[model samples]
Target: MTVIDAVRGDLAEVRAEVDATLDRFLAGKAGTAPDPCLPPLVEVLRGFVAGGKRLRPLFCHCGFLAAGGSPDDRAVVWTGAALEMFHTFALVHDDIMDRSAMRRGRPTVHRLLAEHFAGSREDDGVAAERFGMNLAILVGDMCFAWTDELLDRVEVDPPRWREVRALLHTMRTELIAGQYLDLGGDPRSTADPVRSAWRMTRLKTARYTVDLPLRIGAALAGGDAALMRACGAYGRPVGEAFQLRDDLLGVFGDPGVTGKPDLDDLRAGKPTVLMALARQQATPEQREVISALHGDPDLDEERAERLRDVVVATGAAERVERLITIRAERALSALRSSSMAPAAKASLSDLVAHATRRAR
Candidate 1:
């Protein structure tokens, strides 16, 4: 079943509310563009924002409820909206860096922009790829600005807002730090490659995707230190499992089902723990296969098939799967021991599957 079908009533309510908030916000943005050229840009941003699973917002609401906040509170709802907008900014820039061709089963924003600008700049000799990259960067910046504006609209008291902003500042900082690690852009990255990959997963994927969002919601609800600590206990492992599963999917998932190419991460030689494990376990022959095909810009379906075989042959894929299961269990164990409301606990339990096992 789809996530909407699988989740119970109240969770579905927030999903609908968050979607409405985004639609209304972006629609108004489209109409209010100061320049004629800007409206279409706004529309593109709107379309991009419309495609995600709203995982961040859902997690945020779960945290709020867990912290004893009322379900009727619109402040948490708007905060969820802000989270989704920030996610948009992250995604656009990520695609550019990964040189991804598609997202949500469609051409990525940069590629679309490249095509859009190609004709206009045909005679000026500006390369389409460069122009597209430049414009998409601006679009990402716009989302960054919009995220702050959305947060500004939430009617929370100054103290609560201050706490939330501090959490956001930390989240944003770690997000950039994690990205640099992934890009080998950090000087402090460990020399041990597997440990480095794990660090990147912790900083970039796990914390960004799940941990801080949960805490942000909890903080908004005035959750105390113990409650926020509980949020971390459940969130950190679940988030790690979530990203580990994504690593598997990126290499093995069906593009038709995933709505994303399986080849990109493999092509980028993303320094995932999965790859680290595979390399360590590989025989010399298998090692040669990896060195030959992985990270090759021209890697094709036939070669990717060989690399997939090597990963499975080395037992790396199986090992990663085991890690995901272990991490998920850790999360569930943490949940069972928490003092969260039963409704909050149950909703979070339901979401673990979404976090770790969704096809897309």
Candidate 2:
């Protein structure tokens, strides 16, 4: 089997463990006469978990294996599961903050809750919408709580925990900082595409998505500082490439495969590398079109496609694709230089290639 297949196998195992732990936790609460909304909240959690590919857990497992860990050791799986739980926590909050309506093709937690409230109300829909959002906020909090609980239950050594803690803290803090930067937009914002994109990509995507998980897994396996550093070096570039691919998908991907509308990022004015580049190079007419339509929630698919055409015609797509290629190469080079076993090196290389080249 290929490395991706192996990674998927490991991710499935970790996901199952997380599922059982969450079920048991919910059951305990149920037995104690939990809130009426708690059952629905758990149902939302299940939906959220089901929607993901568990990429974080897969990275964690791969890092553990690269650090000389055995597949049979259950701690590796538990550690991987902890990363997935943390990722779920982040996504739940992100969707709320983004005011997103969908995730992985299903209604977002807040949106779903709002819909439920709307159906039950006799009066106008506004009050119901507000109530549903409130409940979703609470349910998302519960998911975050469960993430912490999962981490607390892991049986890794104290030193390993410390290492994982450091990475987790960095990942969480950096992502929030990136989110703040993203939300706090400026007409006068620093307009350097490379600088802005790097800042956003590193904190918002790279460190959290790839580096931290790899470090956590490797550290848990008692990998040396050199090896851990190598993982970070390797992961950063791969993560950036992965996000670049995601940015492309956000604009140009197939809705059926991506589980999100194409060009949704353009409508959201996500400040992605593509957008930054487009802004840098667009003609006055092109800029006008972008400014008029970007982040406009009312923008229909036809208008969104027009904006996408502008981005492509302006060569932003080409620029971003070049960067993706560069990052992918760097990731491969990092793996080659690392001291990991040959099989592990092959696995990581395959992962980097797959992530960078995927259509969605």
Candidate 3:
């Protein structure tokens, strides 16, 4: 089997076991638990974690293997679990912050919780939204709490935990900062969409999605500075490619498969690399249409399809695709030269390919 095939096998086992552990953790909690009611938190976490691709955990495990740590080791499993919990927490908070409606073909935590609240005797919209957001925020906090608790179970030295902690904190901060930057929509940078898109992609998605997971995994496996640096070099480009692929999907992917509204990115005025390129290359009249329709919530299918035509006719999608291909190639080159184990390199290569080529 290929490295990914093997990793998926191991990943299946880890996911089930980790889920059971989370369930147990929730069940064992006292009614008088120090924090808010544990049941809601547990339910939200379990729901959020369901049906995920488990990409972050795979990265963590791959890093361990790359650093010469055995998959059979208990520490590797715990490391992966900790990182997965961290991801769960991040997603809960992210959905709340973004006011997103769905994830992985299901209602997001906030929406789910809000619907549940609305069903109660008090069915006010404002109240439901507030309750849902508050509950989700706390649920996210609870997940974060569990992540740290899982990490503490690792028998690694305090110094090692410190290093991992710093990396985690840095990743979280960067993701939040990226979200803010994206929301602010600074006009000066919008003048040059390619550079702006690259910047946003790197900060908003790449760093947290790819780099931190590998770096933390390597650190936990006692990888040295040079090896860690190599992993970072490998991850960032692959992460960018991953987001670029996501951009492609956002514009062109089937809603049934992608589980998102079509052209939602355009509606959000996301300033993606593809959109920027289209803007840069469009005729004056085409530019006017794009500018007027970019973020219009009332944009209909006819308009959206026309905009898609413009994006393709202008060659922006092709250019972004080229960029994705180039970055994927560079990422592979870096992975090959890194001081990681052969199996680890193979796994990373598979991950890079999967990230770049995913249809949804």
Candidate 4:
């Protein structure tokens, strides 16, 4: 079989294994829970986790193989599951912060909880919202705790385990720092929107989503510093490209296809690279239109369309596409020079394409 084909086949299998592992783990937790409320939380988390692309776990799997770890080692799979759990925690908190109503095409955790309590005696609308946010926060915290528990179960040797744990610690710290930056305010309002957006992307998405996952997996396999560096070299550019593509999708993608409203980003005043670029390039009249309409809570389809047109007219969307191309090429170049297994390299190449080219 071609290397790419072999990697594809392995990835499909790994994905299945990861899914099963997650199911079994969550089921076990639910079965042993002491409190009745814990069962419901576990169930909600299971549902939330079921709908993702499993990108982090897949990357970890690829990294494990790249570093000469046995594909048959189930410890790697459990580690990937731990990463996914952490991701769930991040998403739950992110949704709360954004006041997002939908995720993976369903009511968000907070929204689900809000609706559950809508008709209760204490269900003033605002109170219901507050209650939902509070509950979701606790749920997110539980998921974070679960991540450490899952990692603790993975049976690596002491030396490799220490390395992996350190990577995990760094990943968690960087993610929190990035999230804090993201919560600071809208990028458009910042003095240097591009710089702010880029920093936030690197922290919030790139490192957590790509760099550290690969590093952690490599560490678990006792990969040397050179291999870890190669992973970082390939991961950062591709990860940034992934986020840039997401930025484009947030403004231009079909909600039905993306499984979330396109208007959410604009409504939230998200400080994406696309928006930052548009802000930089817009004419005076265009700037006024953007400032007035971009973050309006009641932003309607008509105004959104106008904002999109302005973004397009400024050529920011095209610029981002070009950026994706550039970054993808850089990742490929790094992969070619790395001393990874041929299969791993082929798989990473495929991932680079997938990450940068997806409709959603």
Overall local distance difference test of candidate 3: 0.78
lDDT of all predictions: 0.88, 0.75, 0.78, 0.88
Per-residue lDDT of 86-157 in model 1, one digit per residue for the tens?
A: 989999999999989999888899988888778877545347888888889999999999999999988877
The stretch of ten residues in a row with the least summed lDDT in candidate 4 is 1-10
- The predicted structure with the larger TM-score, 1 or 3, is 1
Colliding pairs, model 3: none
lDDT per residue, candidate 4, 1-360, as tens digits? 111233477787887888888889999999999988788778877888888778889889889989999999989999999999999999999999999988888889988877776786466789989988998999899899999999988998999999998889898898887887777655453788888889899988889888889888888888999999999999999899999989998999988877889899999888788998998999999899889988888999999999999999998999999999999999999999999989789889888988888887
Check candidate 4 and list the clashing pairs. Answer: none
Error of 3 at 228 (Å): 1.1
Backbone collisions counted per model: 0, 0, 0, 0
Positional deviation of 131 in candidate 4, in angstroms? 1.5
Q: Which stretches of candidate 4 lie over 4 Å from their true place?
A: 1-7, 119-122, 185-189
Q: Which consecutive 10 residues in model 2 have the weakest lDDT in total? A: 1-10
37: Cα error in model 2, Å:
3.2
Candidates 3 and 4 compared by TM-score, better number: 4
Which consecutive 10 residues in model 3 have the weakest lDDT in total? Answer: 1-10
The alpha-carbon lDDT assigned to residue 351 of candidate 4 equals: 86
Q: What is the C-alpha RMSD of each candidate to the true structure, in Å?
A: 1.6, 2.8, 2.8, 2.8
97, model 3: CA deviation in Å? 3.1
The residue-by-residue lDDT of candidate 3 on 1-360, one tens digit each, is 122333435555655666666556556543446766566656666666765666777787778778877777767667667777778887888777667787777888888888876787466898899898998898888778878788777777777778888988887788777776666456768567678777888887788778888888888788889988988899899889988888888899887887767766777777777788899999998898889888787788899998888889888899989999999999999988888998788778878887888766
